[model samples]
Target chain A: MNNIKELLKEQIKFTDGYLDKYLAEKDNPQNIIYKAMRYSVFAGGKRLRPILMMNTCKMCGGDVNEVIPFACALEMIHTYSLIHDDLPAMDNDDLRRGMPTSHIKFGEATAILAGDALLNKAFEVVSQYNGNNPQRAIKAMNMLAVSSGTEGMIGGQIVDMESEGKDITLDELKYLHLNKTGAIIRSACTVGALMGGASDGEIKAVDEFAQNLGVAFQIQDDILDVTGDEKELGKPIGSDAEENKNTYVKLVGLEKSKELAKEYSEKAKKSLEMFGEKAEFLINLTDYLIDRKF
Target chain B: MNNIKELLKEQIKFTDGYLDKYLAEKDNPQNIIYKAMRYSVFAGGKRLRPILMMNTCKMCGGDVNEVIPFACALEMIHTYSLIHDDLPAMDNDDLRRGMPTSHIKFGEATAILAGDALLNKAFEVVSQYNGNNPQRAIKAMNMLAVSSGTEGMIGGQIVDMESEGKDITLDELKYLHLNKTGAIIRSACTVGALMGGASDGEIKAVDEFAQNLGVAFQIQDDILDVTGDEKELGKPIGSDAEENKNTYVKLVGLEKSKELAKEYSEKAKKSLEMFGEKAEFLINLTDYLIDRKF
Candidate 1:
């Protein structure tokens, strides 16, 4: 556990360094957008997605350098989504990662533009990949777009928004989480594997592992929201409940939700059996993510 | 002139067919998002960007089929920008092309998501391009992403938003319009030419042409906002003045703005002399776009 924690810390540091370089501020007049973009991006994110992608690439026998741009691009996409979700018209979140949201810090219009710019920048970064394998890059880019788009993240967001204050069925909830949170997570692993030249069988294994792990990760988030230290979580507890959000903890009992998260985590780990001892980092990651308090 | 108008009409028809096919709705849980996206996309747009791209591709001796996906993608990017620009937090316009704005019709959240989905879909469409020239497709895709990103459209938007109600300098106003409206227009021509297998010199010519035409189109829009008919424009005139927005007419007098538009249009048409008589449609387009009342 301690070794996993140390590895995670190093991954965060490495990811942040690459992200900073990719998103370095310009001296142009429209630099406010850059600032707002960087603000949300560097706001103490756990860097879980990028870390997952990089490790997955390494585990699949790919060079980390080749996947750096893609991992950073995914982080940018994630940050952009958070910025947009924090808008007053959406989740109305004023604080994210214990700092003022983009809209709060840079006015509504600039914040919106910043979010748009970040999303555009993500595609721009990936499109600039002039690597040896153009076809593979194109495939990864397509997957990222689809995962972050209407059929994936946005679709999940819409359903979640519509289902607010309503008693949604468990299937509906799963669908929401699967699209909203799960799709991008799955994309991170799959894109990494694809870019790493993983065989079809290996890609399938990572896809299944990512899908189950994504759901488990979200369930843990729900659990933490209900039973978490405010200081540790960096936001007030019960806010989801206050907003009448349909979370796993609310739909299923807390204990049942915990059991389900564990079940999913176990299933996630099972998917990595083909990799055996080579997937030690990923196995430990599954355990660490599921057992995380914050 | 009549011949040019006929060509323009045919282009619009052709572009719309492809757009409709590209954005065909699905029977899914997130169908509302699709509906909202299609609503704004089909809302009587002139399809100028796609028309320019396809024409440029044809004139450059590249098969129009090779550029069809890119042309449609540019149109989607244009539509998404309009959707976002019409949000309550941005321009706050109620009507676009005689129809209710996305936010006015679909609510703020869905409007934002629809805009995002469209942007993501544009990339997805382009990334799926599997022509014989994968490298060329990647180059076109990169150009599209960069042109629509912060250094282009969003950069222009930030400046425009910040200069609202302020006495911005003429250069500042020009920079704002050049970015906000010109980047994607230039991209339309350049990407089309590139995809059409145009040489470096030919690409340069189209780039210059599109840049000047974009600014001319924007200047004409400003002029029309002050002097054109509300019913013809499909929205209120003088809204820029009402909002104290900086425009070409506001920064320069009305006559000078018109002259500037003409001057830019002439420059735009001049750049196409390299293509000689084959560029008749584009030359006429420059004139028609600048002289448009709406």
Candidate 2:
């Protein structure tokens, strides 16, 4: 709804469609699982996470072009999660962005293998990155591992699955949302800071901003499930209610959840205060996360 | 058998559960997937593959302890594949080494998640080896990525699933088996060479040894399916035959499969000629892979 459209355009322009040319080499790099991996990775999404990462880097004095592979790597990890989460054994959703999900189009085995390949390749891409400092690469890689591994998003998923259709405390719900959604969001910011060679204090501020923003993002999703238009959301409205999922609105009232989301959005914006006027995009993004219909 | 057992003992001693204190802090690392991952990885097994790696590194003039993490990493990948392969949707097995399969012991969801965690953690372990020679670490990591990714083992898995109960050419069968079994086996040897600073000639020889040895290993399993005693094998004999799976003995006669195994065994031994007597452990390991009953 703002200047992000242009930024998104520039980022997605560089991200999509090029992978196939690389895959179409004389050696037939375009193998079946690679095709499946590439299909989901290149599938048309907003590329919001990568754009946020790149723009944040540029704002903090890093070359966005130099960080392109990492941006692609983040997209790869994000896409891998979507692929796995759509498996029959996992989230089991058949539709994504109005097209059949990866498992639905490719067989289940290929879908599983595609996720596996993407995850392995992500580290490969990051390893290829000879950043200005090796220690920073090590820290960034460690951040990614924790964010994606059992201790972070995966841990959150396990707890969420166990809590489904059951009463969960607000504390547990917050922990789940923070680890599940906030972990990656925070990781994207941390990656930007590392690439940009930010000071430790600046990195801490970014982490706080991301964490607050992530809560608002999930809270907005809860609001959307109850109020959003199906066509706009591209899925069933009230589906969360139907699933009996433990959510912000379910635990607290809808009014309270909305208030909480606003509180988080404000705190997110507050974390960007030190950047003065250069943090407009982040501030706007925080507001947009809680304000959007979907 | 005479010298190999002694070497196995020596190699195992080099690893010596020495990381117990550091890993203990991280061990049972507080999440279901983390706990399950440790259970699958650190739980007692033959340690045969890691031992092979250690001995090969020693034979090539590398520090055995320096390569220990890679040795552990290789086993993690192997364990992960085994765990996933036994899932209900995959091999659907219930027993491994006379114990419940990973999917049977943990629920399918946890089993799947556990495998996913281990695979991710394997790369995490490898990426941490940023020694003085970052280039060697990079080369080793890239080799690992290719060997483990879509173009290698997972591709084989996809083809193996698609071709189950279908007729296939011998070349196709070899391709499938080579990738499914041979890729990591080849990796085990090459990783050792990479650690040891082996010449290209040395690396090539070890690679040849690994490939032929891989064929022998798979052929031995095929032979064991029909001829091995159940007691020794710790499971039902003739299992592959009962599944109507395509195996070497099924395509060619039993005698020919045995002859092929012998030929491959000879080739493997000859590949080690450059290293002369120093490769005795690897030579013995090759013999053990082709000649063992279970």
Candidate 3:
């Protein structure tokens, strides 16, 4: 597609409208936590996870509404992570999406509580998804929990933090990145596959598709750190490089890293070949995710 | 009645043992988030909330084992709240329960993720309720969510923070406290009633019992600040006073606050009057709550 910017902009519009609708805002609100939660959730992003889930589910012939709650839950979980990560004790980010971070806009206590509220609310939102496929819904929830919980993103975050300034093996870095970023991305596709009622074989294919796409996406992020602009990226470019992070780029030279990303992207595309030419969105997404600069 | 401390000690021991088993420790595990989660969860505490749930359930003829998961879920939720509260952007507390807080022990990133994991794990734990009461289980889950989420504790925390240095009306103060402290306490009893398979009327009674108890317990905390020792309280006794918090003792004099607490404690006991002698543990717990030094 020649209009990637326009498509990305439209997707962000959907994210804004849908998230605002789901998280109703009120004036003269009694609680500060609710206000802070609304602030972080609406703080704005491209809604990448939700878009991937919706596009993937649509490719598998599922209605978007059926997957909307889980889509929103993914965003909520992501937002909660950002809000918490921006706290002074963590990454200490002052600006997010070119505005004050949650801890900057709201006080630190309110920001922390807001993150907590969003986190608890994500499960509540997912649990409300009671369609004819109750078992699948439960399975999707279980997958979401495992990917988002201690064994996944949280685990990876700890490894990343602990490994900072200290030398770590390439294997350790890969494991950390896979769990931190890879697990949820893969889960998003698997969730969409299950939501669309994919056959067992198709479900397995979708899992591989997403897993490869996630690795490729992360490697692309490593590439971006070396070759990105602050304006395009919407945050400081090469921040990771400055931090001496054990990124894919750091472990392998630039040439090898690019080759690895290309290999993973091709693998991701091949996984969807089982669905034949019908999986247009999945195919384009795999290309778009790795090729995009920001 | 003097043996109540012995009972509390015994209950604390059992809760610590059970909770410790679930948060199994490892030596510098592969997953940083998992290790951080275990670190914060197994950090010793009084285990007051879960004990309240189990003891209340037991008083209502429910086997403690059947309710243990939900009981642990309460503690998980509590632990999450504490971790978030200890974040540098939150309460910024370095110590809790006479030990380093979660954010202090683990870095802020891991601490945040640990709290996030614990909160999700709490909901997953609800799936373990073996009481064969799906409706009750769903209801309990909803109650736990609403009380701990944006509508309850988070809401209360917001107003409490915003009300800092500003004069809040008595009505505002009451509403804040009700949502902040009362909601979860009320839900704890309701969860206990659900596990015990109480009749509708019995559940109603337990909720009322908890509401009264919550108000009384909060008032007692307000009083303890003015008249408590550091060793007995295990914290700076007058921190609330130092913070100039709008506590019951601040709004009304100490004598009147004590009277209000005593009045509520009496009403709390009367709410359980319907269960007659079968609710002895609850009655004693209510007495202990309102009269305890810490």
Candidate 4:
């Protein structure tokens, strides 16, 4: 567990550097929005998405440098979503990662533009990848755009917002989680595999691994919302219930949700059997993510 | 003027069909956001950006069919910007194109998400374009992303928001309008030329033409707000002053603003002189856009 923690910290630092290099505030004359973007991005995120992408790339024996732009792009997309999600018209949250949310620090309009800028910059960063495999880069970019769009994250957001304080079916809940969180996670692994030149079968396996891991990750989030410590979690606990959001914990109870999370985690781990020792880090990372309290 | 109006009406109808095909509501399981996206997109927009792109492509001897997806993507991006700009936190606009603005027709959250979806989907549509020149498509996408991002439209929006009700220099006003309106308009021309396989020199000329046209178009907008009829304009006039926005008319007075607009329009038309008769439609379109009542 400690080894996994060390790896996670190291990867986070590396991704932070890449993010700063790509989106440094000095390059932009419109400094305030850039500053706001940097604020949320450098706000001590776990860097789980980029790290997952990097590790999957490594597992497939690909050069990490080639995919760093794409990896950083995923993180930017994630950060933008968080900024918008915390807006007054959305979740209306005040704190994120133990710091003032973007809107709380900057004004709402600046925050909104910051989010928009980050999303646009994410595509800009990937589009600048003049790699040996421009075709692969274009493919990865297309998948990233699709996963972050209406059929994916934004679509899930609409459903989630509409379902608030209302009865939602288990299938509806699954649909929301799959698109909201699952889509990007799946894209992260798939892009990593594509950058690494993985075969179709191998890419399919990575997709399966990420799909289960994404659901398990959300289930853990639900569990933590019910039982997390605010000091460790950064934000306050019980926000999910306060928002009247449907969750795995809400539908299946704590113990059953825990069991389900474990099931999904196991499924994710099993998906790595084809990679054998090369996927050891991924297998351990799954356990670590499922065991996370924050 | 009547001939240009007929051409404009024909172009709008063509773009409307393309928008409907690309963003049809029935295609997505998340039906509400899709419906919201379609509503604002079909809200009687002038289709200026896409029409500019298509016409430039035609002037470059490029197949309009090959660039229609890119043309439509530009419109989607334009629509998304308008949707977000109309948010209560931003402009708080109640009406657009004589219809209720996005947030008025849909709820604020849905409107925001719909804007986000449209932005992402714009890139998706362009990415799926299987043109003969993949490199050109990628280059055009990069330019599109940059123009619509921090250094372009969003950047302009930030300054405009911050400068409201405050004394601003003509240079600052120029900078604001350049980014807020100029970036996308210039991109529409540049991308069209790129898709049409224009030479570097030709692309440069188109860029200059578009830049002058963009500034002229904005000045015309300012002039219209001060003096044009509300009925023909669809929305009420003089809302710029009500919003305390700084405009060319505010800085230079209506007569000077009109003269400046004419100067830019002439410059834009002159840039296309190298194309001889091939530029006839573009020259006429430039005049029509600058002389628009709506």
The alpha-carbon RMSD values of the candidates against the true structure, listed in the order shown, are 1.2, 2.7, 2.9, 1.4
**How badly does each model clash, as a count of residue pairs?**
0, 0, 3, 0
TM-score result, candidate 4: 0.97
How do these models rank on TM-score, best leading? 1, 4, 2, 3
Per-candidate DockQ versus the true complex? 0.85, 0.47, 0.46, 0.73
lDDT of 4 by residue, A1-294 (tens): 999888888888888899998887765447888899999999887888898889888898898888888899999999999999999889998888878899999988888888888888998898886666666778888989999988888888888888888988888999999999899999999999889888899999999999999999999999999999888888778988887789998888899999999999999999989999999999999999888877
Per-residue C-alpha lDDT of model 1 across residues B1-294, encoded as one tens digit per residue: 788888888888888898888888888788899899899989998999899999899889989989988999988889999999999899888988888999999999999889888898999899987768887788899899999988999998888888777898988888887888889999999999998889999999999999899888988999999999998898788988888888889888899999999999999999999998889889888888887777
The residue pairs that clash in candidate 3, if any, are: A32-B158, A108-B89, A155-B33
* Pairs of residues at least 3 apart in sequence or in different chains that clash in candidate 2: none
DockQ value of candidate 3: 0.46
Which CAPRI level is candidate 1?
Answer: high
- Write candidate 3's Cα lDDT for A64-110 as tens digits: 78888888888888888888778887888999879899889877777
Find the candidate with the highest lDDT and give its number: 1
> In terms of docking quality, how is candidate 3 classified?
acceptable
Q: Please, what are the lDDT tens digits per residue for candidate 2 over residues A171-245?
A: 989989887767878888878877877788888888888888888889999999998988888888888889898
Q: Quick one: how many clashes does candidate 3 have?
A: 3
TM-score for predicted model 2 compared with the true structure: 0.92
lDDT of 4 at A135: 68
Enumerate residue pairs that collide in model 1: none
